[model samples]
Target: MSAPDPKTPDDDPLVTQARLRRERHERWLREGDMSIGRRLAQIGVLGWIFVAPTLAGLFIGRWLDARHGTGIFWSAPLMLLGLCLGGWSAWKWMNSR
Candidate 1:
């Protein structure tokens, strides 16, 4: 009798499915356009990215004011700085591929 044909796991149906999925992902990356869900997720991420630093600055400034017995002097400046920095960061992130 003839011998059986040799085959690798790459020939399996599961492997074929996985390969197709990977190809689709690569195509999506190349196209650089995402679905609405992805856009919404990106917005959420960007919002957090902008808000985190502002919140952190506010907390730190508040702590400093409490420790130094100062008014909103420190807090106001720091908060504004944080706002500018966050805006800059978010802008860069949005522009990046």
Candidate 2:
């Protein structure tokens, strides 16, 4: 293999400055990607807020079933409905934002 040539005037200060600025601009474009963890946390908070009441109702119904053992099943559909509605709301909110 041949030895490489020494640096030339093509490597002048103005050229170097332009190259540095281009690199910085590209770096910013790469780093501007959204954080998946942050998005997931926002969705989780949405789900929690929307689903809390249904889950609480489920729990209370289950507790009441300590006497009858039937109210618990009655709450299952509510839980599922809550999950669907909450997920829809979360997706809508995220997409809107």
Candidate 3:
């Protein structure tokens, strides 16, 4: 007769989720709640992350349009591209935290 394989309890999804939740709760208790100032700072940083790339794209697009005399053609597309880049960057930053 073949011996039965041993199953690891930690491999279960529910067990993993409970473990994560407990760790997070412990960390929160250890660190205390986030201050209002800290939250505001985080918000500011997120805004800057989303805005900087967009403004850069707009400025560059404007310069290109002016140099090539293409009216608003380049500016519009570049601005949209910049907005997308900024949004993606902000999303990634949020997820990392």
Candidate 4:
């Protein structure tokens, strides 16, 4: 009788699971886990990514309001726009990782 091919979809599920696990283990051994400090640094970067643009928007809006004497009209919308932009940027950055 001919032996079953391991590469075939009909191969044993347990054997497939074991092979996947072994591959994952080998990959983990090659690339170590993320350190606590590295994780914290990533968090900080994300925070800045979200905050910097928002703050810049607020300041610029305020400046424009001061120039035109609009009294919060420009400031409010600009700040909201900044918030949306920052949020979108942060979301994209997170997804890329």
Q: Which candidate has the top score in lDDT? A: 3
TM-score against truth, every candidate? 0.65, 0.41, 0.83, 0.70
lDDT of 3: 0.94
lDDT of 2: 0.73
lDDT of 3 at 77: 90
Clash pairs, candidate 3, are: none
| Candidate 2 per-residue C-alpha lDDT over 1-97 given as tens digits, one digit per residue, 9 for 90 to 100 | 9999877766788888888789878987988866899888886788686787568756665666766777567577666776676667767776665
TM-score of 1: 0.65
lDDT of 3 by residue, 8-94 (tens): 897788999999889989999999999999999999999999999899989999999999999999899989999999999999999
Clashes of 2: 0
- Better lDDT candidate (2, 4): 4
Report the lDDT tens digits of candidate 4 across residue range 1-97. Answer: 9987557654879878889889888988998788999999999999998998888899999999999999998888888898999999999999876
**Per-prediction tally of clashes:** 0, 0, 0, 0
Q: Return the candidate ranking by lDDT, descending.
A: 3, 4, 1, 2
**Consecutive 10-residue window with the lowest summed lDDT within model 1:** 72-81
Q: What's the lDDT for residue 48 in model 1? A: 88
Clashes of 1: 0
Residue-level error in angstroms, candidate 2, position 24? 21
Worst 10 residues of 3 by lDDT: 3-12
Residue range 1-97, candidate 1, lDDT tens digits: 9999988898899999999889889999899777899999999999988998898888889999999999886798888888888999999999774
